[model samples]
Target: MLKREDSAVSKPEIQKVGKYDVKEELGHGAMAVVYRGYDPFINREVAIKITDTDRGNDKDSAAHRRRLFFNEARIAAMLDHPNIIHVHDAGIEGSYCYLVMEYVKGAKTLKEFNKKNEILPVEKVIEIIFKCCKALDYAHSMGVVHRDIKPSNIMMTSDMDVKIGDFSIAQIISAEVTQIGGIIGSPKYMSPEQVKEEEITSQTDLFSLGSVMYELLAHVVPFDSENVSSLVFKIVNETPLPVSHYNKDIPEELEQIVQKAMAKDPRNRYPRGLDFAADLSKVYRNLKRPVVDIKEQAKFEQMKKLNFFRGFFDSELTEVIRAGAWEQYGVGEHIITEGDIDDSFYVIISGDVLVKKGDKAIVALKPGDCFGEMGYLAKTQRTADIVSLTPVSLIKVSGTLIEKMTVHCQLRFNRIFLRTLIARLSKTSEELAKYRPL
Candidate 1:
């Protein structure tokens, strides 16, 4: 009763597949048809991916498609990450082979967001890709390499959580390719190494993720050509126009991350998934502007008064103020919590603040004095807590915005940053001299 009356969708639709009762067709692709199915044993719904090699294809092509189906089952079994689709069952009944996975109701592929009108907001894109990086990290930890990381393979549930599927071309890192053979991944998403038909590593997945990010933000693939040969050559030899070229509003830091992930040489890419995720986290935290209400002119006036910003022209200072977050904090509030991951350079506009490590107060800072210099320069976690000694107002500048400033403005900040570092080092030297004997 579960078998089809005819291999074609003609001759009265057949019903079940093994023990599961097929409901309705969800969607279909070249080699598979997905169905909304019910598993009576578990009383739960599932998505059944049934291999569909039509009567026209040769045996070789059909065999390859079947291998991909079973290979996905094997790969999915090794992965239990939240961001990956969970495979429930895989079976061969009569002439049919099918794989079942957790059904995400109203699930949609990221390909839906690739259009210009459908592009996601910048922060939302960052969050989605950040989750993807975490998933890849977990899979790579298990020695699995997802050879194909394309937009269509990434699913977004109704609730907005991401799930990466289609591990059909994925391979075990240390094993020989026995089932799914050849360079069989979407050309637009392939890395340089993949285009060259060379062995690849986890970094290839990162490259593919970068390609996906490019398309999501810019609404165009990084590399596209008229034919496969031209595309492969471009993947290996050409550089895409900067993402900012397409969407001027994309953050500079995000564009840099995209370039690095898609670097031609694998060695130049993020060494680990953790490393890639870390940078994305940084971008998410600092690049997003805080919602606030402050007159731009008033903020610019406050910034120009600071001795640190004396060299900036009125226009340059205006640009800096517009880029930074101007906010006020209550007395005794933590301005920068110790061990918090942030790279915001702050300048006290009014009131005083104190720097501390544990129970010890390191120093006191006043209006016109800037803090977070080392943290901003080093791009790491805060080493000490900066607490408002009194009700305070300050401007917090993120590194992402700084890159977009004028050359003169950037150079001035750099010079003042160096001067601050030198002054601190000098004070430390003076204190050390007290311990020295003549």
Candidate 2:
């Protein structure tokens, strides 16, 4: 759950904790309350996490809770990853123990992205998981296991940067085992080993991360039940519905990645967090990146407005858009050289290019103009050199991609090429007549 400063319960809040002054309640989890705080000496805003001790029944329970809070502070302080939340200070004052952390205003948790009807975009989800994987890798290298890796513990900044928070249940492998056997972590996101209360490892974090990714992409938890018993039973014995069953748009490759991460046996899951991150990075590179997509759409729209495509249907234009690759050339850069045997064409989106033959400037082509049609359509050697007269944006269409176009689109393209060829030949004849032997 994400609680903004404005939506705080309006109850009387803590005025101060050590050197920091509390501004308001930011959020509250079962074990602690997070507060918006201001550090006076540093004049910086911070988040303060205070342990909730009211739930402790006796002296032993209260000490156990305190130990848990201190354990979190120690574990979090040891981590120095960008994705992992930074711990600034921790101290105990009377009955209250608090930790000062880096504050992220307007921050939301991954839980918000898991809404049934409003899941996050697949790319965004992949990026979040990728970051989490690296963060976990760093923590694991430091001999720490964030036993409770779940959506609510992963915070998202206003700019969509991920911050993996809440290490209250973390286990430091190098430290003496003070707590064990008792079940820990959220049941819904737990690994099969966690459900069975078996010895946990770095692989446990990957399993929980897989659950978080699944919820974000498919808008449903991998294992859900009305009671803890059934939930634990399912996690230990059942297989989750393939993510594609819930969201078909999710690629099969991505589904397989998620499945392997959430495998029932630790041996089947990624060997390390770095391995998981590597797979996510591959998906990131292959997916239509947001920045690239925006630029491509702009090119597509420009293509639609050109006279060359005026007669083309929307479907045909879309095919062309998919077939073409955008490229840029600097002034004096050669696009096509004379006598080159390449079957590709170019259309100028911006700037100008000079068509040259035997060191003679033939003609200058500007925006919306095309060259190399003869080479592309006839599969012959280039007759001239096309060099950029100014910095240029060009759409390059390869013969291979064009060959994959639908029959109707290919026919339309061929007709336009023929018309363009005739027009150029006619102009050449007129020039030849003007230059006839005098």
Pick by lDDT: which candidate is best? 1
For model 1, residues 1-438, the per-residue Cα lDDT tens digits are 555545454222437888899998887777777889999999999999887544344787767777887788889889998889999999976546789999999988999988666779998899899889889988998988898999999999997889999898898887766746578889999999888889889999999999999999889999999999999999999999999999999888899999999999999999877677767866786665444578887887777777877777888888777667777888998888887755569989999999999999999999999999777688677899999989999988866567557888888888999999999999999999999999
In candidate 1 the C-alpha lDDT for residue 86 amounts to 95
TM-score versus the correct structure, for each prediction: 0.67, 0.65
Cα shift from native, residue 389, model 1 (Å): 15
Weakest ten-residue segment in model 1 by summed lDDT: 5-14
Give the per-residue Cα lDDT of candidate 1 at 381: 76
For candidate 2, the per-residue lDDT at 416 reads 80
In model 2, what is the error at residue 35, expressed in angstroms? 0.3
Q: Give the TM-score of candidate 1.
A: 0.67
Q: Model 2, range 1-438, lDDT digits (tens) per residue? A: 121233323232578878888988888866678889999999999999987453444567677779888888888788998789999999887556789999998999988877665568898898789879878988999999999999989999998888999888899885876753378778999998988888889999999999999999888899999999999899999999999999989987899999999999899999988778767755664574221243656876888877777788888777877667667778998989898765568888889999999899999998888889888778688989999999988777765457567898888878888888898899999999998998
What local lDDT does model 2 show for residue 338? 91
